[model samples]
Target: MNYRLKLIVSFALLISLAFGIGGTLLISSSYYSLLGEEESAIINEYETLQNNLMMINHFSSASSAQNMQELIDQMVERNMAHWQALSIKSSGETILESGDQSLILNYVNSTKEGTYSYVHINEGSSRRLLLYSKMSTKNDVLDLRASFDLSTSYKQWKSQLRMFWAIYVMVVILGVAVAILFANILTKRLQSLTNATKEIAGGNLSMRTGLRTDDEFEQLSRDFDIMADQLQENIQQLKEDVQRKENFMGAVAHELKTPLTSIIGYADLMRQGGLDEGDRLTAANYIYSEGQRLEKLSHKILDLLLMEKDTFTLRKISMRSFMEQILTTTYPLARKKNVNLVVSSDDVYIFIEPDLAKSLLYNLIDNAIKATPEGGNVKVIARGIKGGCEFDISDTGCGMENKELAKITEAFYRVDKSRSRAQGGAGLGLTLCKRIVDLHNGNMVFTSKPGSGSRVVVQLFGNMSQEVDYEK
Candidate 1:
């Protein structure tokens, strides 16, 4: 059943149960007490009659006994009008009978002594109450009995019960009417609530249950409305985020296409085969430089995506040897600018992805060498750190300001645009390098100041903790 009906029915049942229990106790107690009082009177009369008959027997006269019985019967009739019926018996035979007197015989047999009392129910009718007794005297014993008609008492109580039931019937009729009235009102409210809920479920956030009753149900309705409002706000925010990501993707496409278009155009001019060696060489140089820029852009975008996905593996490589090889490869670039590229190692060894480690070292060293002026020095050092390997590259170069250094690893971000371009770099090398290190669960840090120097440190974690060997 619905909640409101359940509540009303529950309350009504509680009241009905209370009434039923109380009525049963009251009716039962009254019935038993009435039966007890009748029995008491019968016992008293039988005892008195027994005493008088015994005196009459001492006189040895039937006339006197009969006279005494008459007088006692008359006295009983006068004093106890509440007694419904009476009877007299002698030697197991009825001398006088009244009001279902066979009921008296049953009690006479049961009360064989001078006097006794008990409740006797009529056969086939548990509802009827009969209180009876027997008395005795000398050899010619008289059986005196008083019979109280339980049907009389039961009828009286039932008449009162009939009146009570009439009132009870009227009460039930009124209760039903009130129940329907309340049930209707509650059902209507619930139907409205259900309709509003369906609309809200169909994505209409504006729909609301406008119940204003100051109760718990009203509070729940208000809470549902608030939750719908918050849901709407969150959906709108997600839509805006999707739009922003789309715009950023378009911007990135345009940026990457610029270098590719330049490189392709230069390559086509060289392929036309209408130029001297000098012109061909120049065209080739343009194509090569633009190709490098395009490659850098492509690598940066790929790195950013990969970092988000975080798919990388650590493979065995010697950090000391890796740094030395990187220095040897970059020696020509430093020499061309009349700068010294110093390579040093504390002989650190660790297992990691060789390519990623190489890229990280190359990015930092290239940045340092490019920033260094003529006759400046770029120092590269690799050593063991706590359970990891560290590479520190420091250059006495034209370092970045605090603001520029903070964004140094951002794609396409540079302190001096033309200087970075002239140095054959696309400003993505550091960003890609940082992302690759991050994928290996490593960190990259930079220390720099404008016009003084710059230092970049990279830490690659050791394999000790990642020894969940697949081969095993």
Candidate 2:
């Protein structure tokens, strides 16, 4: 069943159980209390009659047994007027009897002495109480029984019970009404949350349960909203990742297919064996050049794929020594381009994977060198920072626009595509550098404008260690 019905029914059952048990006990206690009161009154009357009989017997002026018997009979007759519905029996023979004596026989042979008992009698439409007492006299045993009509009290008790039942029914109705109201309120709130969940399931991630009750349900609603928010964020991130991968794959395919197509065309022409020696040599050269381009593209793609799965082992390395090593390797390219190369650093050590760090530096330095004009300057500076180390590569190159700088790290995204391609650039260097810096728990920041020189700063967050891995 739905929550509304379940809540209503459950509340009703609980109230019913509480009232059912309580009402039964209340009525039963009232009944016994009334019966006890009647019984007490009757017992008092029996005791009073016994006291009067004793007094009459003690003061009698009779010396003979026959005379005493005559005196007792007179006393009983005089007192009979005071006792309504009363009966007196001596030794199984009735001395005096009046009104509704039917229940007297039941107590006649009882062995109990000097005690009273109460019995209920049913006569037509009325109920009666019989109080029987046994008393001992000098000459005989007397059984005194008092009959009382309980019809009046019984009618009062029944009437009270009827009123109580009416009240109980009213209370139950009120309880049921309250239960339904509470259940509907609770269920409606829960239903709103459920509907929000359904909407989210139907791909409307913006759906939210804006419940604002100051209770636990409200907290639960808040928690549900947070969960939905996280779910939406995660799903969005997943979509972006998928889209990025698709774009990357499409770019790689295009890059690879272009070179392969050129190579294939040139090779086919050479294979046809129709061109002269010089033309055939030219075709061979074209095929070789395209093959080299394809090879370089494939290597870069492999590097990116491996970097995705690559693990790092960070160790201590001297900042100055590391820069010197990179500068030695990069000096040839700078000299070939007739660009000035400079390196400056403070003597410091940092934790880094040597190979990945070298690759990161190489990509940045190489890109800086390639971007600079023939007579421009490229500077590499390394230093100890608060947490770890920082490297700044500044180049007097043709700087990039803000928009181009934002997308420069994206694979195959070049500021000057034609110039980059002419300079043998596949546009994967910055992308690889960015990935490495991320893996090292660091960040890269670029500062440049269309005309001004560009400065790329690399920040690595790591602990400084005096010890260095000489082998690495």
- How many collisions between residues are there in candidate 1? 0
Candidate 1 regions exceeding 4 Å error are 1-82, 89-128, 131-145, 149-248, 264-280, 299-319, 347-351, 381-383, 460-472
RMSD of each: 7.6, 3.8
Clashing pairs in 1: none
What does candidate 2's lDDT look like per residue over 1-472, in tens digits?
9879888888888888798778878887888788788766766756666666555444554422344345446646776333337676777777766655664555443547667677688777677776777776666667777766667667877887788788888888898999999998998899999999999999999999989999988999999999999999999999999999999999988888877888888888888888999999898887877777777778778888898996666778888888889988999999999999999988877777778888899989999998899999999989989877899899999898878788999988888888876776788888989988887789999999766679999988754333456532
Q: Scored by Cα lDDT, where does model 1 land?
A: 0.70
Superposed Cα deviation of residue 177, candidate 2 (Å)? 1.4
TM-score of each: 0.62, 0.89
lDDT, residue 376, candidate 2:
97
Summarize candidate 1's per-residue lDDT along 188-265 as a digit string, tens digits. 777777888899789786888877778876887788778778887888789987875675477467666776787778
